[model samples]
Target: MQLDRLVARTMSRFAKGGLASLRPRQAPAEATAPLAATGPDRPRGSGSWANEWVGTKAAVERAKSLARPGRKRKSGKAAADSIPEGTIRTKPLMSARGVKLHNWISDRLEAEAPTCTLHACVSLGAFLSADTAHEGHDPLAGLVADLLIVDETGQPIAALIRENVADPSRHLLMLDALLDADLPIIDLPAKPTLSMLWGEIAETLPGA
Candidate 1:
């Protein structure tokens, strides 16, 4: 009976601090375990962490998103090469030759097309164009140029080229592209007539 009582007291004392001691001892076992197992026997690189489950899911989704073509911005010669063999970025919106020169003219013209917008303006041109097939978040994302042209004598030319187009959205795109894309001097006309401008602007890529 005495031995039983003594054993009970001893067991109680060990139980009181056993959990604390077990924690430190178990750490070494966890260190040797696979990274995926977050338990005491698992290692740090075992890919086991508090957020490991959600991390794996997010990585998978990110990979899928990146796999889609044209979903991301391409750069350098590779980016320019992405243009199709037959489809040229500077193709004429009206005739087969006169290439649409500015991003604004092309984007606005597209917006006014059938699948695009169908509205027209008195002073400028139509609110949309005929070749437009899709829409975008900013309907007028590309419509005008933002620039001030000059001649040999530094006289500001009144030509309506991209640098001085009237549309606000187009202006912003031109500015952004100029700063970001290192654009070269492009050929444009001064104060292009409304008819000629629309004929040129309908099929341009926005901010291109």
Candidate 2:
């Protein structure tokens, strides 16, 4: 990776500065009142010292600044569409069913980049969406994915995938016998299975 000249210079300056404090400290003022726990000798408003007021005021200012409106945010759909380059999206090459295919893709992505988010489409009631943000499940679970797979029974692909990935979860065997009726599902090699599953992943990855 190449560094820009200005950025490199700034980093060098930081390195030379080490980890010491950079700002000048001001002197503390005398206390306005006695300790609050004390009787009438103490100051009013439950205050121990005037410095407390200064700290409180500074905190209030910071809170106000944070609460103020930032630059109007871009629309959610537009922001999602601006995904960075080199992002991999593909249908699963080896799975018993399409939902399994979706999970297979997610698992591979997690293996490649554990921190990268994975999402799955879900449906509730009569509507379908990638709104797993409100699912109240594991915090580390991937975000709601855009791609959705459904069987003739209308079961959400996300639910099935989540079940397969999470521990102590319900088992979901593929039951959609009709989907492969029109097309021939590719069969994995018998006995020698190592080459069958991983080969698909290798071919999909870059520089494979």
Candidate 3:
């Protein structure tokens, strides 16, 4: 029993000493010393520490960049090329050809068509007729004719207008509407006359 006790004591001491010896020791002060005050390219320590520091800094910068907000997304309804509101002029918006046609019609009504009178002041831009002009009506709506001809009695004589060659679809639609309405349509040429217009209207009339 005494021999077993001595062996146990020796074993206990050996076990404690063995475990202490197996544990890793703290690094020397010199081994873990700070690098010299030098540029990154000239690091004093083994390159592993400098490389780890550089990698950490790079990761932090990358995280910052990722967290930054990006540009806001544009709305679906927003158009890059759309004209600003109120910027579009309601009147005097007609093309040069439209203006010339308006003047010609005005002159003819004043000189030859004494029974007919100018319906409204001619403007270059599209305008809604009293029949169509109402609340919720789009002022910038497409037009069927450049001018509406009316008699002194305020009867709609015809739609005296010109075709817009630039927009074939719009021109066709306008022409179709006039035909469906059974209204007289006088297509103005590059240069139109009062007599030619009157002749067309007379043909459409019942007892001309």
Candidate 4:
């Protein structure tokens, strides 16, 4: 497949210089914090890192810089007609259901066997995102991952995304563009139960 030069550039950059370390082998700063315990009734913020589907404000900005599209659509519709491309307006774009779901995922991972292929297993709430950064021959840019997983070197291992609550067209566009770049994307329902999420993830679980 003729990948967009920009996408190639991103892959190359990630492979070469670690532009922005998304998820390395070591635990995230938050993961170092102690968890009170994993249970059915754990409070939201007790002993757990904040559930940031995106990230910190500074982190969000950094991610945006990397994912920003190279050029605007030339159609005469102006900015109004363009995709918002904004990942966040509020600090953390999470839902009540999402909070529980994310927490459960975090807890469950910690309870699982070691050497999990999904780095999220080691570092809960980890995320990965990619799109054309440079002005290469790619057609789309500013792609974002609600939840993505990567290896020690920031290479995309897998993409586990719940259905996007924003522009579906743009989300689909991003998925298509990512597929061209040879990244895999998995879709779950907007409100997947913990069991449902785990079931979906089981497919990607390669080794025991």
Candidate 5:
């Protein structure tokens, strides 16, 4: 009985503060961990610029919301993406050569046994809330995904980015924000073969 009681008391002390003592050492990592990324971790080259575009953009939106709380933004992104209301599309909504790559991805989704969903030109602003909130949250305002793969419940599971890498100013920012938002990002080149696209998509999915 004495040994059991002592063990319980020692455990109580450890539970009370032992965890907290370790937190200070982990503070910096924790500060950055809020930028949690999920899905395919692509090899962004060494030259990828580390900018605070997400926080800056978020701050701007927050300020706008505060100044005009009564004002509301419209849903014109759908029109920009050329997506029709009330329909599930097989291929991504695009008007360029990227159609081939987008089509390949849609085909892949259709073949999945459990059957994930495919969405084209998904507006990050529509589903993400970081725009009206604080810094560090990915404010994906005015950003769109080339394609989004969602689970059966309409929750985004993966994203495909078809970007012009020449413009890192926007592309890199989008990449970082998507990572911070905890969404998987797949980089599909404009002109990839069936095997090339498969490799890119497969790398991000589980087990590769």
Candidate 6:
């Protein structure tokens, strides 16, 4: 009976030792201390730092590009150059009396006279300097012509007046002002067809 009891006790101790050997051993607290100490104050991981640096560099390059000079202006010779050699830009002529005055004088001239060029909105004062400078006699003082027809050599030909049916008085005033400035006026018909307007322009030309 005593021998059997000793064998049973030894077997139980061997079984418990085998179970403990099978279980995984926990790492020491000192071994995990370095991982726990890593926080915001510490340097970031390699991948995180590289990504942040790349983002910052891209932003700086973009800022530098914007600050650089030699930027093209939208309204001057640069804008004109961007258009094709023969294409004409057109816009609506604003009027107060609900009459839609189309101001494609430049466009039409460009299309018809490929050799002859036309300039839009040239100041009357540029040609009528003497009249404009005369005191209390502002002939072109608050008046603007639609276009200046010029030959390819840039010779001033005539001043174009696009008529608005709703404002006959204004048209007459502009016509008188242009005449006083000693500039030939090409008065277009109110709601004129392209063919009709072109015919009038052809007649107004010196040799046409």
Best by lDDT: 5
Ranking by lDDT: 5, 6, 3, 4, 1, 2
Weakest 10 consecutive residues of candidate 3 by summed lDDT = 121-130
Question: In candidate 4, how many clashes are counted?
Answer: 1
lDDT accuracy of residue 123 in candidate 1: 15
lDDT of 5 by residue, 20-39 (tens): 33222222332222333455
Q: What is the lDDT of residue 201 in candidate 5?
A: 65
What are the clashing pairs of model 5?
none
For 14-114, candidate 4 gives per-residue lDDT tens digits of 56754234342333656353444478875554322332212333454554454445644566443331343333365545666756666666566556622
RMSD of each: 26.3, 22.2, 33.8, 16.7, 21.4, 31.5
Show where candidate 4 strays beyond 4 Å. Answer: 1-90, 113-133, 136-140, 206-208
Candidate 6 lDDT by residue in tens digits, 44-63 = 43233334334434554554
The full ranking of all candidates by TM-score, starting with the best, is 5, 4, 6, 3, 1, 2
Error of 5 at 161 (Å): 0.7
**TM-score of each candidate structure, all chains considered together:** 0.18, 0.17, 0.40, 0.43, 0.47, 0.41
| Alpha-carbon lDDT, every model | 0.38, 0.37, 0.56, 0.50, 0.59, 0.56
Candidate 3 per-residue lDDT over residues 1-208, each given as its tens digit: 3333334554575567743333343444443443356666663534444344344345545544543446244554432325543465655556687666567666766766767654433331232243444676533356556667767666666777676889988778667666656777777776766678667855644345
1-208 per-residue lDDT for model 2 (tens digits): 1123324544465478732322323324452222235576644542323344344345545544543456344553323224444465897543455445556656765676343333344322222322443776433233322233333344422222223345232211111221212211222222224446545444433334
Off by over 4 Å in 6: 1-112, 164-170
Clash count of each predicted structure: 22, 2, 1, 1, 0, 0
lDDT of 1 by residue, 35-80 (tens): 3554786445423332433343455455545544667555433332
Model 1 misplacement above 4 A: 1-92, 95-164, 191-208
